[model samples]
Target: MAASVQIVDYVEQGQSLYIQLKVIDAETGTAVEGEVRFLGELLYGELIHEKKSPLADPVRIETIAYLKTHFGR
Candidate 1:
């Protein structure tokens, strides 16, 4: 069964925006729930001068930058 995805907006304590992706059953048009593990490429950010901040992962930094850019910090 094909699943459709949509982003539900959310904000974290660090003032970063998050996309709560929802997976829906394509045929029945129902929100498919229960621990759905998804593998996806981290969608945004520029690899700046390889320095480290509190954000330890590259994907986390990228996602935060993406949200700030897209949603306006």
Candidate 2:
């Protein structure tokens, strides 16, 4: 029963980038563990990129910092 998702980590393989997220349950205010369905998309100009994750959990904050730096956002 997750109400929202938060970025947990970002990974790069070759030329592709991947983002990991944590599903948060609104009722308990805690992250749901184990495999969970995930769908995400990124839009750049006229092109769109999509990704999915079956299982995701918490990761170091440094991962998020890296993403911010890499994306210059």
TM-score of each: 0.29, 0.30
lDDT of candidate 2 over 1-73, digit per residue (tens): 2235465676555544555555554545655433221123231211011233222222222323433454554
Distance from true location, Cα of 60 in model 2, Å:
23
Worst 10 residues of 2 by lDDT: 41-50
Number of clashes found in candidate 2: 0
Error of 1 at 39 (Å): 29
Residue 11 shift from truth in candidate 2, angstroms: 1.2
What total of clashing residue pairs does each candidate reach? 0, 0
Tens digit of lDDT per residue, candidate 1, span 1-73?
2444444644444433344544454444555322111123233222211353223244334434544455555
The lDDT, on a scale of 0 to 1, for candidate 2 is 0.38
- Can you list the residue pairs that collide in candidate 2? none
